[model samples]
Target: MNILIFGYGNPGRGDDALGPELVAAIQAENIPGIECQDDMQLQVEHVTDLTGRDAILFIDADASCVAPFHFSEISAEKDDSYTSHAMTPHALLHAFHTVYGKDAPPAFLMRIRGYQFELGEALSSDASENLEAASLFIRNLCKSPYAESWRSLHRG
Candidate 1:
């Protein structure tokens, strides 16, 4: 199965780099067909990669009032604004489906907190630790084969 992962963040910034850094940490595992990208934010062009993917996941850092390790499963219908948790997942999914035709791949957003995104060159020690945890999760996920849970099937 094709697994498409988009890790969003600003690498130049401090805690903002968490998304991309975590993705990079997902070392070689049995999962061979995984495709991962570190993007500033998703654009409509990304819809092209949604074709025939068993599953897709986006990881980003959010400024939420929660624990440092909180993660959530977001549907395509949710906001997924790539900026704030306030965005609705369903809305974004609908937008993609409208633009790309009603066959956008099944997607989920995993947002992490406890980040202080400063305009700096390095990541904070706390954010670095969280990135490691998130990376390990992705590594294991890619190893597993796709199930019906992640999708309703889309066009290629």
Candidate 2:
């Protein structure tokens, strides 16, 4: 049941902080079998961090996704962001498979919907509401045994 919850986003930005903020909230719960980590953005080095993990959950802010969040399983598809500073979850998974010589661990992406993303601005009221909803949803997941099984299911 080992699980890694990786959240990334810029906290200084208004709604862009949703990812890291959610990680903070989840860490405060101190739930067993769950390890939460956060960053301003994903990096190539993060690919190695997935080693020995049963499952990984990548969380980020999305301006066009459904309000609150959209959760879906992710696979190790080739991505062109290999040369970019910030890498996508798919890119990270691809790196993991290439470097480790094994299938990447089951992974899921939780794209939290956001409205504002101005630098140095506080979270917007609408973003706050969305954050609350996402927090509750993730909290319930932490308490449920089936939470980790989400990676096994495919939702087109």
Candidate 3:
């Protein structure tokens, strides 16, 4: 399947760099049928990126998720972040639907567990371990990029 793996976070902040770090690793693999992107944050303009992909995986660092990571399928919905400059994955899906006049392709969010999101700090040792675990999980998921297969791996 044609897949887009979009990872977003502020690399300048500790642990928040997980998303971008993971994206960099995946990009280096040169996996076929997979396109990877990294950004400081998600924006409404990103709706364009959703077009023509069979599936999308949005990755971010989450302060509240369980250790290692959390994963789940997401649907279009207008939430409070819809009005902000930085949009959430759900808000981005909503925009995709509103702009394209159809439901977005199967989309999922993988929130890697993080701590110490302070500016100018490097990734914490604990968060680094979590990132390693999440990295393995994503690599396996990419091998079978089907919606149902992805859903079966969901954890929170």
- Return the top candidate by lDDT: 3
Q: Give lDDT per model, in order.
A: 0.63, 0.84, 0.93
Superposed on all Cα atoms, the candidates' RMSDs to the truth, in angstroms, are 5.8, 2.0, 0.7
Question: Can you write out model 1's per-residue Cα lDDT over 47-109, one digit (the tens) per residue?
Answer: 665677776777777667243444444456544563453333345556667776774666766
Model 2, backbone clash pairs (residues 3+ apart or across chains), number? 0
TM-score per prediction, in order, is 0.76, 0.92, 0.98
Which residue runs of candidate 1 sit more than 4 Å off their true CA positions?
Answer: 27-30, 65-68, 78-92, 147-156
What TM-score quantifies how close candidate 1 is to the native fold? 0.76
Per-residue lDDT of model 3, residues 1-156, tens digit only: 799999999999999999999999999999999999999999998999999999999999999999989989999989989788799999999999999999999999999999999999999999999999989999999899888789888787
In model 3, the runs with Cα more than 4 Å from the true position are: none
Q: Under the 3 Å rule for N, CA and C atoms, how many clashes does model 1 have?
A: 8
Descending-lDDT candidate ranking: 3, 2, 1
